[model samples]
Target: EAMLLSLYDHACFVLGHLEWSEGMRGNHYLACIAGLSVAAAYFPACRWTAQLRRWCAEQLRIEARYQFLPDGGNFEASIAYHRFSAEMLGWATWFLNRTPEGHNILGRDREFWLLLERITTFTEQTTYRSGVAPQIGDNDSGRFVSFLPLADDAESYGTWHADPHPYLSQRNHRETCALLRAVCRNEEHILDALFDDQTQHRQACFYAHTFGVAVLRNAEAEVFLRAGSIGQRGKGGHAHNDQLSITLALDGQEVIADPGTGIYLAQPAMRNRFRSTRMHSTLALDSVEQETWCEGGGEALFWLTSDRAHARIVAATERLIIAEHTAWHLPHRRVVRLEDGTLVIEDFFAAPSEATIWFHLHPHVRADRTGEGVRLEMPQAHAILTASGGATIMLEESLYSHSYGVWTPTRAIAIQPSGTRTQVTIRWQLRS
Candidate 1:
């Protein structure tokens, strides 16, 4: 009772003088609202507690409508961060359901419940069969809470304690799933499938137009395309210069990988390179970034400003998806199609421009150069890449980070068309 009273007192103080960031409506502020509401629910009968819970319920409803898009993607545009914010929302839902007063806030909140279900579905969709979430945008391994016994987050400027294993990685995605399965009315079996690393999925392509991501899956492989906006309403704090980038998963392994965020702030140079357009599996004109990177400090530490790309999907279907973005002062269009178990990617532009295309191999994959392209040997499959344009393929050293503050040396296939190009069609054939 005393703990409850103390929390109630603290909630009142916080409500009286709230400090919201002027920059963005991010999870940092929403988390505080969720925490204060949870505390108020513990003493629902107290007058201040009652008032605080009402305010939190209203604010959550308002922010969640904007923070999570119609398809349930967190507007930060980072998949790892979705897990963090979803956990906070799920936690608040669990406790709020327990109290009669809190019930008024949630029981009839149909829109909120639908958002939770959508968020849950998104988590299940984006995670790979390897049990890792895509390092799509910025993956700093943020977590709302760690229930594990030995989990400790590595600081941006400190020695890595996330050793021997990625305990600090929130990409496992099960924690958020577990909470939603219990409280969000999503089917338990769906969440159950994610926990076991089910290697296969239902037969159909999936696309979230609201999030601007497209997925193509077969019995043994999955293809993901990041063709979306510079999220955070163009602030780009957590977004990357990864427009038209793609990743491939085969037999539960990430064969074609996106270099996850290297340590931020501490190693600013590495951070800049990792988030650069060149580090992604996409085309960059004259080796320029898709979006100009924010360098140095403060907002530059996270923001990817000058977001004029306006990347988006032009057309999509069960078997084909096409997207384009105008960055580097040119329009680059990518067409993704799967035929006869081979993934075909075609890039098109109107005028000739010096262009470089990158396909980053997972650290575990073995890469060898061939006259036509490069051959990739992954644990689950072997694949070969070829291009229609004249290619000068070079094996370049790259880095891959699965969790915060940790990275391993990898190799990338950097393809520079023999000359400035107007069209480049790259295709990959995978063999089991």
Candidate 2:
């Protein structure tokens, strides 16, 4: 009894400092509040327990209402952060429900459940058939808690001895679906369909207007596109300047991927490079980034100003999806068509500009330029990329980061127009 009390006392002290120091603002802040609340729930006789419970309850309510957008997307603009927030909120709800006095502290139970449903559905819809998110922004590969056991091989996490990122093989989508299944008891069918790869591919496109994201999937291919604001309200937290960028997967294998985020604080140059427009699978005008980076301290970090882009799904069908975005004072449109095993992408720029359209290939994919275009060869897939409008097509050295703090040398196909003002159309046809 004495040892248990001592441990409880230590928890109380640490949680009290965390609550008092870091107010509930961001994802991590809310997590701290949740942890403190759970700790306080154990000491019902403590004088501060009631007040702490009320404070934590109010913080959770605020986060559910404001931190998450109406469409169920996290305002931080990072899918990985979304997962973190969802897990923290889920644990907090569960802990509070376990106590008699805290059962109704969530205020409107319906609203809370609706928020959870929206977030989970968004995650399910955004996930690729291969069971991974698009790596849209900064992916530190963070998670709030680990219910599953860690891998026996420590090196699977990363090269760094104490890497905070999750193991490379960890499937966040599968884990998230499991969490949602437990929380959303009544929505078994929705979760079942999400978990089933065959069912997910039956759906044509998942479009979220709130986040300006679109995921088009066919039986054999999937394409993820981003044409929205840089983070929430342009704060650019955990967001990349990758407006109108796309990631492609064929037959459950990544062919073209979003050059994922490298180390954040350890290497600022690499961080900036990874988030730059040139590194994404998009069109870059004279190698200039779509959004200007502002240096800030702490959570403020970096943001983009005067580069708010708006994207809309112009047309979508079972086999075709057309979307457009205006950024860097230019309007760019992308039309994707998937038929059988072939996927074709057509890019249209509104005005004349010296732009380079990049297609960053996966590390395992081999590329070579032929007379017609570039041929990309993989283990079980092949792609032929050809461009019109007299564009100069070439392959350039690039880098691909499969996880945080790790990078591999690769290649990207660059299509540059011969003149400043030209209508360039590039196509990618996949062959068996």
Candidate 3:
């Protein structure tokens, strides 16, 4: 029983040391509260157990109500952190339901289940047919627990090894859906509909207005677009300046891809580079970033603030999605449409502006510039990008990181319009 007592002591120590102030709010705070609940329930006889339980219960309620939106999207704006928060709350609620004192904490509450349901819905909508979540924002691949065996190297604790695609393919949507099914018991039908491939294919568009994200999917292709706030109120923490960016997949293979986040903290230059506008698949004006990163000491390090850039979905339908974002007092709009087997993107600028629209290709995809436009060749898929309005098309060297600390050389198509306003179209034709 000495081991059990030691574990209890450690739990108490963790609970005692958690900073309960406003500054300590976030995933860290929620994790500590969850640990405290587990500890209190385990050692109910402890003198501080009652008080700790009350504090944790109240904090859980408050966080559930405030940290997440009405549609269940985490206000933090990081999809990785969204999953992290959901797992924390899921564990806490699951553990609490087993204890007599905590049985009613999340009991039969419509609002509570609705929150979880919406979050799960968002995740389902964003997940690709290959079971990978689009690397929309910062993705450190953080997890609360490591159920899988780890590599022997200590430094490899946080860094993703090789390509994260295989790892993501193994656990991304399946686990999240399973957790949602377990926690929100009343929402089984919703989960079933989301997980069912037949049902998902019939649905053309999945738009989360609350998060400003839209996913267009069909039997043969999937497109993910981002036109949302720059990472929670433009603070830009864990957010890339990729407003109006798009990621494309065809025949269950990624073609145009988001350069997944590279190393963090260890290499600030690389961090800034990976999060820069040049690395993303979007338009960059005068090569200026939409948000500026501040290099400060300690926790404020790498904090970013936008230059008054904002994004909104102006129009959305099963076949088309139009989104607009304003940066530096100039509005840039992107219109994406899926017609037959062709995927078309039309970019519009309010004024004559020197801008470059980028389309970053997956490392495996081959590209050749044709007279009409560019020919993209991927496994089981092919596409041709045709630009109008006198746009100059060129290829540039780029980088793609499937995992942290590992970067691969890639290429991106840069479309520079000669006039103030121009339209470029990418016609993707899948080969059977």
Candidate 4:
């Protein structure tokens, strides 16, 4: 207990200096440092040992390096951080008996409490209704949990952590907030609904680049596509050179995906190399990606119409979409329609430009080149996809490996968009 108090003391001292850089700041780290400092003193324990003192002090120092943003957003770009901060602050407030002066060793716990709440509020505003957080940073589907709401000062601090944090131990930012609200209201039904074990929820998911395009979908096959840019403002880390990209779901599973941001410093070499456009399902003209490691440029744009000739749910019963975007730069207007129970992507682009288009699937999904265009085989689902027609598609072996898990390609196919204002199309179908 003494050691934890000392760590908190050290954190307060370091943060008093205010020297955190943009690359190293985040909300969760701040909350953890604050929470740990307060937790150490609030909870009873045996006499503090010298080793514990040293560890706590070191943690305080390390955490101080992470400063909070003006909007109370974390610099790391992950919504999970925001949720974690909120819970930490709530715990800190409850532990100190809601009095800042009570934890004398930690000094001002109130600042941490307020900051965590503010950050969480920002996250709540950004979260989509489907529960999937924006792919702002290093995110995978694995981070999901549901927490129930509880009333403020209605429960003991220790009991709150013991009860809620465990079940939501691995939940994402949105789940944590929902859980908090449920607990606050004392709504048993909401708590039970969120706590139901062993079920998967994937709805209103989106992956987007700044000034590029944002893609989302509900349970139905209809895709919601929004546009953004290449993150010219450097708003977040792991920004991609994919000036214009697409995000969608196929057969109720994630298919085309952003090769996510990998860890930094912990594995410095892996950063920025693999998370570029060569990994997504978007097409690149002339084998060119927007830019590499801050060396290229292009704007990601979008146009939406809730009128006729816009987002028609054709093949609705068959589970497909035919989307048409008004004319933009380049030479041709493009209409993307998925049919034949396979992802058949057709493109009509501007004047004759030598552009090489590639179809990239998630690394976990297998890919191989059959005499057909290119086929993706999912082992878990036991399905195969073949691509053919004017498109020269074939699955190629990949040189990069994923750290989260081991996966190999079944195939990849590249197509050359031909003709001036040419209308080119490729078809995909599933095989038994």
The best-first sequence of candidates by TM-score reads: 3, 1, 2, 4
Q: After superposition, how far is residue 412 of candidate 1 from its true place, in Å?
A: 0.5
**Could you give candidate 3's per-residue lDDT for residues 140-209 as a string of tens digits?**
7766553333233533322222343333322254456455556666333433433442323225798766
Between candidates 1 and 3, name the one with more favorable lDDT.
Answer: 1
CA displacement after TM-score superposition, residue 363 of candidate 2 (Å): 1.1
Lowest summed lDDT across 10 adjacent residues in model 4 is found at 301-310
The TM-score measured for candidate 4 stands at 0.53
Candidate 1: list runs displaced more than 4 Å.
1-19, 146-169, 186-203, 351-353, 418-432
Question: Whose TM-score is higher: candidate 2's or candidate 4's?
Answer: 2
Which model is ahead, 1 or 4, in terms of lDDT?
1
Give Cα distance to truth, residue 316, candidate 3, Å. 1.5
Cα lDDT tens digits, model 4, 68-183, are 34355544434444455445443443343223333332334445445554454555544444343434334422322224432234243223222322233232344555544443
lDDT of each: 0.73, 0.69, 0.71, 0.40
Q: Kindly indicate the candidate among 3 and 4 with the higher TM-score.
A: 3
- What residue runs in model 4 are displaced by over 4 Å at the alpha carbon? 1-4, 17-213, 218-226, 229-232, 247-252, 263-270, 285-288, 292-348, 351-353, 370-372, 379-389, 399-411, 419-432
Q: Candidate 3 overall Cα lDDT vs. reference?
A: 0.71
Regions of model 3 farther than 4 Å from truth: 19-24, 38-51, 146-171, 186-202, 232-234, 296-301, 351-353
Cα error of candidate 3 at position 221, Å: 1.4
